[model samples]
Target: MAEFSTNDSTNFSYPRSDYVEIVVVRHGETAWNAISRIQGQLDVELNETGRQQAAAVGDRLSKESKLSVIYSSDLQRASETAQIIASRCGGVEVVKDADLRERHLGDLQGLVYHEMAKTNPNAYKAFVSKNEDMEIPGGGESLVQLFDRSTSALLRIGMKHIGERVVVVTHGGFIRSLYKRACPNGRPAGKVLNTSVSVFHLHVEDKWVLKMWGDVSHLSQTGFLQSGFGGDRTSG
Candidate 1:
């Protein structure tokens, strides 16, 4: 977690207490995700189970207070999830932004990891090794590119909702990207379950801070406590 406050000659007053609480929710499962394929920019709709997941998340969020704004990736899956949440919150408007979309997978768009590994050993190896500079052959984004775009989207959201509680519905990869950025030197091992919530506290002083992460208590009530999708569960 980065320090949220820093003093400078400009004399910007940093909020002493937590001002803005950003809740990040990954969109429900998609067909591509179920098959273990690299989705990237490829558009895929949520399965029926995913719709149920989103509804559950909406039900949970509807009970919370101080929900000011709802933002989501323009991708159908994310937008649909945001819409479900908004519908539960008395028809709150959902703001869509393309910047929040998942990292462009380029050439790896629809390929499964196992297939890619067997066909493109070097590329698969580089990805598994977390090589920031290695680009997937034919297409696919490098790790650095994913980080840049993900962080840019987060910063934009942070600025837009400076002192409010904003809900962001995005992809698992997008959330994972932020985690990697926040814990650069640490081993990257965190899963973003469908409808899981990650909270971050942003201060204007210096850098944004991660307050809480991967809270899936809402799903526990439904007897679904596992991270990510359990198996080849498809969405509508």
Candidate 2:
């Protein structure tokens, strides 16, 4: 009768910490991303532009701050981005964490937003609305499930590296979920661009602060970053 705790958002909490700066970077674009197809747990590789984005992000991080560690989703896109960043950082270790992965979207894995809307309007509505309880028809998770998954893993990392900077290479959906959770009173969460950087700080009393969200200045100057890969409602 009970749901998996890590897959439910309302019950998760960050452990107390002195201070920790987390730079959450969504993974680079994939072929699925160009067309706005859902990627769930699929291990897709980064497209050429995505590879460039990853390298840009890595270069930005190496110049912006000193990272103590990098925690990345083991999914290919994210893992490859982390590897590129590690190489750019000149040997920063990237720890693979399945917990850092995107929400497992189940049967909705590869459907485009418009296709889902045309085929299953209600399902498309729920997925787009950020419904906390609307699990995808086949086996996908709710938005809250992703919030719980990401926050739990982030808290564990916070407890271990208080007052340190860490990079999180993960998917867009996961970043969007975490952003909603972190900035409860702020703007409505929207698309998390590929390789966009979001910054969060965990305080000593277990409070979380959103320093920045979807900072894509790096992508803007690069010229390779694609414009409008897909429509507004993203499910990656």
Candidate 3:
């Protein structure tokens, strides 16, 4: 895994405090996530396990820090997760933004990986190769498109918050894109576990320093491991 370091400067002025913190939380597990389906742009709700994950996330955040604002993807899963966090953090209003939605999977929207590999070998290969230039067979987004839009949305949010501590609930792909930009030399070091929390401190110094990534200490008691699409759900 790649090593990461934190910024130690206190000379920057954030909108609210000495440091501006942005916490990124991935939404909990969903039926699609459990069933290995391509859930991109699908408005799926959290299952019972998902709700429990959200509750655990909420409890963890409530005990750890105070948040100024909570934002989330407009999708039901992300929105619901944000709501849980907001409720735990003093009933703060939750803001939903479409820009935070997962990358559109196009023709691959509902197919599982094994199915896609058998039915659309070319598309499967391109996807696995992480080709930024490859487009989805039907109408899926290229990696470049997802990166551009997601980063733009994040910049807009960062500008608004400036120095405030905010929480953003989004999908694994969205968070991965952000991490790639923040650490462009190589792939992000860790997996984005379900309901995992990562912290980034955006500074006026024109740098985004990662404080933590994929922290799942809170889920230890739950005995659940991170699960993703493309395989049977199981502990990691």
Q: Largest lDDT belongs to which candidate?
A: 2
Candidate 1 segments whose C-alpha is farther than 4 A from its true place: 1-18, 120-126, 185-187, 221-236
Q: For model 2, what is the alpha-carbon lDDT of residue 101?
A: 84
- Cα-based TM-score, every candidate: 0.82, 0.84, 0.86
Candidate 2 lDDT over residue span 107-131, tens digit each: 6567874587777766676667745
Cα-based lDDT at residue 33, candidate 2: 81
lDDT of 3 at 204: 60
Q: Over all chains combined, what TM-score does candidate 2 have?
A: 0.84
Each model's lDDT comes to 0.70, 0.74, 0.73
Clashing pairs in 3: 15-163
User: By descending TM-score, how would the candidates be arranged?
Assistant: 3, 2, 1
Return the lDDT, model 2, position 41: 83
How does residue 103 of candidate 3 score in lDDT? 81
Better of 1 and 3 by lDDT: 3
